[model samples]
Target: MVGLQSTEHAGDNCTPLSDERGSYTTAENGFKEKDATDTHEYDVYGDEDTAEIKYRTMVWWKAAALMLAETVSLGILSIPSAFSSLGMVAGCILVIGLGALATATGYVIGSFKLRYPHVHNMADAGEILAGPIGREVLGAAQVIFIVFLCGSHVLTGLIAFDTITEGASCSVVWAVVTAVVCFICTIPRTLNGISYMSVVSFISILAAIFITMITVGVNGHTGTVTASAHLTFAKGFLAVTDIIFAYAGHVAFFTFIAEMKKPEDFPKTLYTLQICDTTLYLIVGIVVYAFVGDTAVAPALGNTGQLVRKIAYGIALPTIIIAGVVNGHVCAKLVFVRIFRRNGMKSKHMNSHTFTGWATWIAICLAIWALAFVIAEVIPFFNDLLGVISAVFASWFTYGISGIFWLHLTPRSERWTTTKQKAKTIFWSLVVMMGALIMVAGLYASIVSIIDGYKSGGFPGPFSCVSRAL
Candidate 1:
């Protein structure tokens, strides 16, 4: 210990963690630890009030269900279309490959949360990664990504409305209806209340997909099947971005982990998301594309014949609405806690008779959902828009940030001290590079696709009322 200058672990705020007592000075970085029995000190919230019990009350299974709903809803619906675009073989490969990588990154996020328990959102982690600037950058990126995700759900609900009612109303009206309903659902003040609907949301999507697979399989008519071994880079990349979207739940992993009754069960949550999404995605994509072929559409429900599509949409209604609610809840919670509970983990005013607190929460719900509505309507194309959003957000939040968190936490000396350590370092370094590649390459593909949409007269003017199907 001669030159080490040993010190206990310190958080970003240099907030003294209770339970572990005596501390004369703070550790400059978060990478070290101190004994639990040292001395007596208290954080701003104190030992008894670290996190309100209400915030961390969720069981692991419920947490998994919530994550599954948030991630698996609209994403799986697009996979058959990705398969159609990239060729069957390549699409399946991407599903498994990207899914595995996303799961790995998700695990990294959980580990980072365990390392720094004070991190309730990407913004907190961002502060740790750099300083004040990192918090602002990463925090904005996180909320924006979640807003886009919520918007995607609202867009899907509009599409579903069209599918079921055969365009009974203008697209804008349908979007408004979806946003209002989702905002209402988002009024719940806690993740525990939201998790109840998430269970239904997950079941709804699963059932809807099962019906679609069966409908396509039983029809026994290959609807213009075309298989290709080759694809242009743009076509292939678009397909890959859809896969990225399917596994792009990293924007939400921190909140889910933070709310868990046992943080150690996070791997179980990751396993739940990947196992279910990957298996369902491959089966649904390959089976549906094998039957529906090149004409297969994003949000696979469209690939079914008219009546069957209507039925599937009806069943999927819950997921379309509830998944967006879950995303909106997380986004709003990030802002809500920051404003009301800035000094502590949970606000005593959250569910109390506090009128201002309730009013603020309601306003946040309306504002976020309304913004999501605008995003959903402004970018009308489903798969193309998702590719754009995924490329812009997921590549960094889900992949790159997780890699950064891992590299930040692991001790520098441990990596170079042994051969195994060196190999591990190389592996994580490549992981970081892979995230950068996805961010750069995927962004290029998305921009190209959006331009193509404009050139081909496929672009609807922002806030235009024209049917998206046109």
Candidate 2:
């Protein structure tokens, strides 16, 4: 497989490649634009032997599918509870406003990549900003966030199964089933392969949500709701965190952008996710809350009538399993690629099928999924867990990290030569502060909520066979 090569051409604007980091040189200006072909950072991401075949092969649409599957998780259904906590007024504001912010920050990450094309993951990006310590910290955080996401998927799949079956079997049984299926689905060697399953995953979610909207409209039963309301600080922040979870795909953005056929097309795919997810979140949150009011469950399908819920959960089956599959694949792929790339055991030059490479990859996938399954069985409050996830991971991955990236790539910190530069600096500083607020406050609220759950016995024990739907 031939990797792309964009060498410098003879032009007056040429900037010679030197010891500099994060230079934005374009092909038209005769500066050598970094490609995955020969960079050490690229090799650290994946060895050159198998790089062309495994990475940098996805089109924008397939990339969107993988991203959509990752970003738009069970969190979409949690938005209505947010509406109930803060009413529709603040709820919509948080959803749309934070969503726009998430989008803008996402663009910052893309810009960082376009400028420094060698970054393959958050660790690499972090190293650019704060050296080796940053790499270790961000790399661990990336794995944690992805692993937690996989666990959330496992938990949600259990809920879907339990809702459909009405607790006919042990809850642990359903969870294990979900884990096994997710593990099997994650065995595909590439995101391009996973992208195929992502199409079905998207359709599954769409069908389930529509079923919910239609059935709720036809056979309506509702409690009182309001467009204006107030919430305690902890409660409001929790709701905001849920909205943040809806756009928590940034952690994987570098990975996704690295694989795209043309990384510039990333925003198109990002917009695809933003439009579809935010719109669905708004519609489903409003419609479900209008029908179920204060008692609306996070995955709103459970808020429907008995038969309607079973049908909706049945339709949602693909998404329940496939979304988790997508996340598990990402988590496993990151670990597998990082290890194999370092060892130079790619299939191109080595027999990856023997005990050395393929077996190790499969083992890594299984280990991550198994850990996710354990997470599903523990703690057990869906909304609370999501709040913790958003606060701890998304705050940095989606918001603060990009702000740092922007500042690093911009003019020197102390002196801005122009008004626009100063303004940009001010704007990013706010972005960073806002992220800090979410991260700190979000953690506090989530922990308090969890404590409250334990006090009220609202939480379940780990590996409980009892149904979690109640």
Badly placed stretches (over 4 Å) of model 1 are 1-53, 223-228, 343-347, 350-353, 379-385
Error of 2 at 277 (Å): 1.6
TM-score for predicted model 1 compared with the true structure? 0.88
**lDDT per residue as tens, model 1, 375-461:** 887765655766766787788887777768767876775566667667767777888888788877887887888788878987667
Q: How would you encode candidate 2's per-residue C-alpha lDDT over 1-470 as one tens digit per residue?
A: 11212234324322222222232433332123554343422222343343334556799999899888777757676787778777877788788888888888988888878766666688767777777688788889999888888888888888888887889999999999999999999987777888988899888888988898788777685766888777778877887787888888888888888778788998898888888888888888888778767766666676678898889889888987888887787777778656643211233312133455667878999999899888878766755876787798899898988788877766464326557667777888899998899899999999889888988987777889998643
Q: Give the CA lDDT, 0 to 100, for residue 452 in model 1.
A: 85
Q: Which candidate number has the best TM-score?
A: 1
* C-alpha lDDT of candidate 2 relative to the true structure: 0.75
